[model samples]
Target: MTMKESERGDGGPGNGRPDTGADERPAEPAGLRGLAALLRPRVSRGQLAGGVLCLLLGFAVVAQVESTGRDTTFATARQDELVGILSDLGQRSERLRGDLRELEETRAELERDAEGETALEEARERAATYGLLAGTVPAEGPGIEMVVGDPGGGVKAINLLDALEELRDAGAEVVQVNNVRAGVDTYFLDGPGGILADGEPLTAPYRFLAIGDPHTMTTALNIPGGLVKTLQGAGASVLINPRAKVTVGAIRSP
Candidate 1:
C-alpha cells in the first residue's frame, strides 16, 4: 500500500529546489560585463552633468518668458501716461511761442511809438529855433543895449538903417528898436517929428535891444568909422551899454 519514491513529488529531481549546477556554468567575459553595466540605467558623472544643464536651461527659459511678459505689461500700462505727457508738453510749447510772439509785437509797437515821439520833438525844436531867429518869438539872453538920442534933429532915417545893418552884421539873433521888431522886412521912414519904424513914429531916446554876444556887438559898433562914430558925427548922442541880459519883447506883426 505505500507509494514508490517516484510517486513522492517532494523528493523528485525537478521538484521546488534551486539547481546546484548554476554555479558550474561558465563565467561571463570582462568586456561583456562592462558592456552590460553601461547599458543598464545608472547615475554617472557625465549623465549628472547633462541633466543639470538641461534643468538650468529650462529654468532660464521660463524666467526669460516671465520677465518679458512683465516688461510688456508695464510698457502697456505706461503708454497712455507717456502719450499724455508728450501732448501736454507740446501744448505748453505752443502757448510759450504765442506769448513770445505777442511780447515781440509789443516791443515793436513801443519802439514805433518812441520813434514817433522823437521825430515830433525834433520838429518842435526846429520850429522854435526858426521862430526865434525870424523875430516872431520873444527872445531873452545876454546881449547889447544902445540908446541913441538926436536932440538937434539932424539924425535921419538913413542913420537908423545903418545902425540896424551894423547890429545884424554883428551876429544879432534878435533886434528891437523902440519896442518894434526889427526883422528882415522892417522899414525906416522919416516922419514929421522923428524916425518911424514899421510906420510907427518912434520918440526920442530910441532904445535898441539886440540879442547876441555882448562883446561882439560892442566891438562892431565901436570900430572906427562904424555906426557909433557915424551917429556921433551927426548931432545924435550914442551910448553903447554891454548888458548881462536884454529882452527883445517885440514880436513880428502877423
Candidate 2:
C-alpha cells in the first residue's frame, strides 16, 4: 500500500501498534462537573452593591452620632466646656453689677459724708465745679433722638458712616444706632447684614439714641447737609424726640 494512502496508526504516531487500555488523557477536575450541576452561579457585580450599602450605613450612623452628641449626651467633654463658659460669663456679669453698686454707694456716701465736715465743706465751696452732681442734680432739659436706619436695604457702609459722622460733628454724644453702642471703636454699618462698629450687626430701623445739648444736637443732626438729610436721601427717616433723661450705658462689642 502507498504510504500516503495508509491509515494513520493510533499508537503514539503513524507506527502500527495496538492501543493500550492505559492510554493517557488529561484528568477532569474532580468536583467541578458535579458541583456545577448543584451549585449557584458566581456573584455578579451588582450582587456586591447590597453589601457595600450595609457598610456605608454603618459609617453614616457613626458620623451623625458624633455630630449631635453634644446636644444629645450630657456629662460629656463638650457639655463641660459649655457649662464652664456659661458659668464664667455669669460670674463676670455678677462682678460687674456688684462693682457698679459699690461705686454708686461710694458716691452716695461721699456726697452725704461731706455735709457737715468743716474742712470738706470749705474745700468743696472753694473748688469751682463746672458741672452739677450727676445723681443729685436733676437733668432738666430738651434733648433729641434722631433715628438712623436703612429701610431701602441697599444702603452702603460709607453712607451709614457719613451719617454717624455728621451726627457726631453736630455734637451728638452717646449715639446708639440700631441697638449698637457707638463707642470709640464702634461701627455703625458696613451695610445691611454687615458690621459697622466693633462687629455689631447693622440692621434696619436703626434707632440712634443721643444724649447731648438737645436743641443743638437736634439742629446739628437735622441740618440740610447733616446725617438726617443724608439718611433721608436713602429713604430713611430721622425723627428726633426730646427727652429729659437719655441714659447711655457702656455697651461692649463682640
Candidate 3:
C-alpha cells in the first residue's frame, strides 16, 4: 500500500500481470511460419523478367551448339583422312577422262575406216565397168543368141552386116560372131565360101552372141519389117534363143 503497491496499480491493463492475454494467444507453428515467409514476395517484376531472360538465353546457347554439330559433316574428321578422300576423288576424275579420250579415238578411227572402205568399193566398181567396156575381160549377162542357116548361099556379107547393126541399135553391149570378137571398128565382106566378119571367116549357121536386155533385142529383130524378116526373105532361116546368161568369152587383144 505504500509506494510499491502504488507502482503496480499504475501499470496499464490488468495491473501488468505478466501480460497473460498475449501469451494466451495461440503461437504459430515453426513449419507454418517458414512456409509463409517463403511465399512472401522478395523480388520485384523487373528482377523476375531478368531471370526469365537469362534462362532463355542459356537454352538458346545450348541449341546453337547442337545445330553446329549436325551441320558440319567432317567437323570431327582428321586432316589425313580428308586428304585421302581428296586424292581418291582426283583418281576417279582422271580415270573418267581417260575413258572419254579412248572413246573419242575409237570414233575417229571408225569414221576413217568407213571413208577408206567406201573409196575402195568405188574403185572396184570402176575397174569392173572399164574392163567390160574395153573388152579386156570376159563378160556375161542377159541377152540373145541368133543362129542363121543359109542353105542356098544367099546370106551374104550385107545380110550379116544388117543383122549386126540391128543388134547394136537394140542395146547390145557386147557382140560376138562365130567365136570372133566384134569391136567398134569391125567390118564384114563376102569371102570365098562364106562371110567375113571382122576379117575372120564365118561359114553358114553363123552364130551371133549378143549381151544386152534379151526382151529388147528379141523384139527389135522380130518386128514386122525388121532384120529377121529381111533375112528370112533372102532364103535364110533364122532361129533366135533368149538366154538368161550369155557369156562372151572372146576378148580383143590389148
C-alpha RMSD by candidate, in order: 12.7, 30.3, 8.1
Candidate 1 vs candidate 3, lDDT winner: 3
> Model 1 misses residue 101 by how many Å?
2.3
- Model 1 lDDT per residue over 1-254, tens place: 35554465664476656555656777799999999999998889999999999999999999999989988764666878878878999999999999999999999999999999999999999998888876788889999899999888888889889989999999888899997998788889998777899898988788899989999999999999889889888978998899999988889865
TM-score of 3: 0.62
User: With candidate 2 superimposed using the best TM-score fit, by how many Å does residue 12's alpha carbon deviate from the native?
Assistant: 99
Residues 40-111, candidate 3, lDDT per residue (tens digit)?
989999999999999999999999989998887576879998889889999999999999999999999999
Q: Order of all candidates by TM-score, from best down to worst?
A: 1, 3, 2
Instruction: Name the candidate that leads on lDDT.
Output: 3
For candidate 1, list the clashing residue pairs, or say none: none
Root-mean-square deviation of candidate 1: 12.7
Alpha-carbon error at 82 in model 2, in Å?
94
Q: Could you estimate the TM-score for every candidate?
A: 0.65, 0.41, 0.62
After superposition, the stretches of candidate 3 with alpha carbons farther than 4 Å from their true spots are: 1-86, 190-194
| CA-lDDT, candidates in order | 0.88, 0.65, 0.89
Worst 10 residues of 2 by lDDT: 128-137
Ten residues in sequence with the least summed lDDT for candidate 3: 14-23
